[model samples]
Target: MQNYFVGSDVGTTGTKSVVIDEGGNILGFSYIEYPLIMPRPGWAEHNPEDYWNAVADTIKHSIEQARIDPRDIRGVSISALAPACILVDKNLTPLQNSHIWMDRRGIKQAQWLRDNIGEARIHASSGNPIDPYYATVKLMWERDNRPELYREAYKIQTAADYPCMKLTGRAITDYSNASLFGAGYDIVNKKWDTALLEEIGLDPDKFPDSFPCDEIIGEVTRAAAQRTGLAPGTPVMAGTVDSVAAWIAGGATENGDMSLAMGTAGVMGVVHKEARFTKNMITIAHAVNSRDTYTTVSAISACGSVLRYFRDTFGQMEMLAAQSSGEEIYDLLIRLAQQAPAGCDGLITVPYFMGERTPVWDPIARAVVFGLSLSHSKSHLLRSFMEGACFALKHNYDLIQQSGIQMNWPLVLTEGGARSPFWRQMVCDMLGVPCVFMKDAKGAPFGNALVAGVGAGVFKDYSVAKQWTEIGASHQPQQENTALYRQLFRIYRNIYEDIKKNYQDLADVTGFH
Candidate 1:
């Protein structure tokens, strides 16, 4: 009579589900990829129905794969991409495609917010800076451009909330996701800043009620059970953003615990006991201690996706070779990258493939590859690309340190890119921090399962996460490489500073923004 829990993650590019036991072993896992709708430049969207369908399909598949009795499952939880604007009508039908986290179509609205509401006042209330990255700006874009749709909407939901609502017919958001709304969520008080919302011309009523991450918000209905293969009336917890789930999965339950989640985007989260806010970072409630603790996140718009972009755009030969040789194309690319020496022989890259998030909140900035030489081969280009991503991470880490937050050493790395030993070593050398990751970590879905276990009373508390985390290989900084990266990192920063002012000009000329 062992209890099991299910965790579902609706991500930017796909949805994943997992079933785990009390000991944190993954019993079942399923992932289904989906396309990101980019109808226009600087716009990213997803049909809300796609999220629900993927969630249902992945959950059913995971349950089937687990080969466990549905009745034995104690609870279910969800994690999803944060701050996405998904407006739905009274019957819970989506008004339109969701404007996801990567969408930069609200740049004008974000600028208006800064001009009218002032950044200081907004930051004082929301604990987030004025940026198109926040849902508040995206909602403004909807209201201004699609007035009919905005007026007809019953409630605005996050990516996570929409699926939970589908599961239980309840529209609610957790504190971690709510803080990213940025319209007027008081991070310190954990409530909507109604006055600030009013000043921003946003209806506070459009937002849903908020709860702690582990709170049992509702129970799955018979209809949802039919679709997801779960028992009817299974308890559903108010989960959290996917990054927070990844943080918990990487053993970041205690204050000062820091983890770098390198998925489609690179997100670095640091837990703090007190509510410390920095203008350069995104601050939100911690998934484990939803009330008292907070986590500051620094994100890159693209991380692993940069490599994906390279593979799709330039790795035709490797792809064909992989098809014949039965090897992963990524492994082949990394092998080629291994041929290049440290510093890529004075070549550097600034990985702002989709603008950037922290350190510099530039929405118009594009990726830059500097010092490309005639003598450089594809291997050198590939290695510089990887180093460029690490440089962007180091840029954020330096600022996090300067912001007066102490990050505990031996930083934990998790998710996709962290699976690569070469990338892990690069991060260690670039940041001068020893790093470790759990072997075969299940990422966000695993953390969602832990949240479910906590809410279902299968576990005492979130501290069990740390106890269950299995540390694998550890990487230390190579002094020679660290010294070279330090020098190159300075040049990387200078390269951006020198050319950033022209990014918007390029965007304007090209009509991309």
Candidate 2:
């Protein structure tokens, strides 16, 4: 019998699962895409039941594909998109749709916290800036707007915690996810800040217990075993945030190394020995060393989503051709982009479709396409949109450097976007650095399985993570493309400044309800 470990990643667009052996080789993989709910502008949500179903289905699918006996699955771990607000009642039933990271409906609550408590204080205590993207602001929004739901919720959980609770009947959150709580978690002290919670009028018991990523949370319950096709005694490791899992998977476990996860959102993270609080980007406790070290994240809300939007909205012919020729639509788009010029003939797009994060932190920001001309084609549009995303990432990369975080060269690229040679080259040109690629960039799920292995004593420690990850190719920047991208990136910055106030004006004019 072959012993295996299972890992699940609850992401923004879907849930992905993988089965891996002690050697860190993936034997099976599966994904289930779900819909993102948009009841109104700047509001994104998903039913908590959907997450539970996705987790169960994907786990079963992975095990079936691996041709493994259920009893041979020794351990499991999960990674999830953080700052998601999942409130549940006494019976652990969801109160309503979860407020995911993409949602920005808590602007009023965020400003209130900033004005009342001061942004500097929040940053000092939480190692993060006060923004609608964090959990507390959304909790405040529910407390103020949906008071009934707020009063009835017994415990507020993160996305990763929810699945763990279902599997183990234990309500607990990992340090990485707890760091995003609005009431503030002391990164250095490794506990929830009681004073901050009291100041915000939040009950401490309402939050779940926090633990380190590799610590075993509990054994899989019989109910969960029946639902997920796993053994009842299988150990469940306390997992981590999705980007941190990507970091571990990319072999950026030590200081000075960096990792980039370009999934639905673009996340750039660097591992550090000490916690550095900055108002510019998010700072969270690292999964590997939650007690002493930290991970700083610069997140862009919609990088891959912008590309998906173009494919769904404008690539009908390409989609049809791909179906007939047995080629992927993304491959067709990449080919089309290759035919276009590097700068897309002066076409520019600012991908703020769901506001902006990281340096700008503007929830009102909107997407814009400049320099459109009659000569432009679909290929140009696609390439320009990709360039726009690169520019956004460059902004965050520069901010990370400006914040005094030292990084080793050749940043590791892990996730779906890393598979595209054209996209990797664009990132190289925009950031003016070499990008290291990995052979199995299956991302968070793979990393989660590795963590499960460690927790189950299948591996010695996280230090063995480097042995599991292998580098594939290195993409060096073209000096000419870098110079050109620098100029375009400058214009990109200026364009945002020039049109910054117009976003609010448009919102006001449209009666932004």
Candidate 3:
């Protein structure tokens, strides 16, 4: 019988599912977007049912489009946004909307943790900094602010685990996702830090069982099969966090290999065999195997989302033109940006629409466009937007280099943002390195599919990842653009330094706290 695998990525704004054959060929894929609820400033959430339904719908749609028999799908795997906390009952129903990775409502709680637990100790234990972005502070916030929900919570699942429980009736989390649970999981020891949990008054029992990335957690139940259009008893892999999946799919399986995913949020990761605890960067256990290797991640909270914001809020004419001409809105925007010269005529932009991660870790950081004048047109703004996004990545890459970790040249770039030649060129020039795009631009789902294949024994191990990943195009840096970008990047860095304090003052004055 022919065999296939299904990989699903439950992301920040949408869920993507891909059907792949045993050889890693993507047969069909479907993406379903859901709304992000921002009940207050710096808060982000989503109904857990939305993710479950979206996964089921996309799986059904992709299977239908592929024209494949459901029985052929031998295994399923998933990757999801991390540091998100979901409170679910024994029935696998969410007690409330899950707090996503972007939520900063627990700022005070995070600070409390830093003050009480000592930030250095938490980082040593969890391989992550104490911040609102991690699940620990958010879970603490729930316990403090909403006592009833915390009391009724049967299990605190990460975003990936929530869907896994729905599909396989197993409450489990991978080591990669468990590392995001903060001080509770000992990254070095590879177990729940029972002492740490007890010190914080968090029940270690509330956390799910931890597994490796490719470990088969359980089989799909009859009910989940009916709703998701899959055959009952199909094996399911534990999967992992989306960033780690991107690392695998981007062909960064070897140590010192780096992959940058420019999705709604930008993430740059370097594959490493040893764990190093840095001040701002996160050292997550690699998904391939949690025991020996690690991956250092620097997350940019807003990357492509800044372009998305520009499109939704100000690109009405471009949207209408694309609609009439049957072109993609991003393509039209790229064409419009081409009219503006490099450096955006001395204009600089900071892409912090949703604050920042990595390096700064400031949740109150705000977006700023400097040196704007009547002379600058919307096209210039658009060009600056692309440049700013690239600059943010460069900033993180520089920090990684400063940590004495040098990545291999020709860094593999994946995700929807890498599909744009214009943006890829910008990243190459700004970072002064050759950037290579992969053939499969479908980001984490493609990676998740490969993990499913590995777990199902259709493939022997993760080395198959390199065979599945192929280079599509290489964008080399132009010396002229590189020199010009360095100058602009200096100003970009300075502007953030000058105005970062103002962001908190403004947020406080505006009652965002």
C-alpha lDDT of all candidate models, in order: 0.89, 0.85, 0.85
Candidate 1: misplaced stretches above 4 Å?
Answer: 316-327
lDDT of 1 by residue, 441-476 (tens): 668898999999998988888887887778898999
Worst 10 residues of 3 by lDDT: 271-280
Q: Return the lDDT, model 3, position 205.
A: 80
Lowest summed lDDT window (length 10), candidate 2: 181-190
Error of 2 at 123 (Å): 1.1
Best by TM-score: 1
Q: Could you give candidate 3's per-residue lDDT for residues 145-258 as a string of tens digits?
A: 889988888889888888898999888888888889887789887789888888887878888888888888999999999999999999999878988887887677778888
Residues 1-513 of candidate 2: C-alpha lDDT, one tens digit per residue: 667999999987899999988777788899998889999987989877878889989998999999888898878999998889988989898888888887888888888887888888888877888888899888888888888988898889888889888999888898888888745677777787777877887777777888888889899999999999998989999899988887888788888789887777888888988666556688878878666778888899788887788889998888999999999888888898888888888999998887888879998888899999999998899999889989999998888887787788888887777778889989999999999877786688988987888888877778767877788888999999999998888889999999897888988888662
* lDDT computed for candidate 1: 0.89
The TM-score values for the models, in the order shown, are 0.95, 0.92, 0.92
Superposed by TM-score, candidate 2 places the C-alpha of residue 414 at a distance from the truth, in angstroms, of: 3.1
Once fitted onto the true fold, the runs of candidate 3 whose alpha carbons sit more than 4 angstroms away are 64-71, 312-329, 373-375
- Residue 343 lDDT, candidate 2, scale 0-100: 85
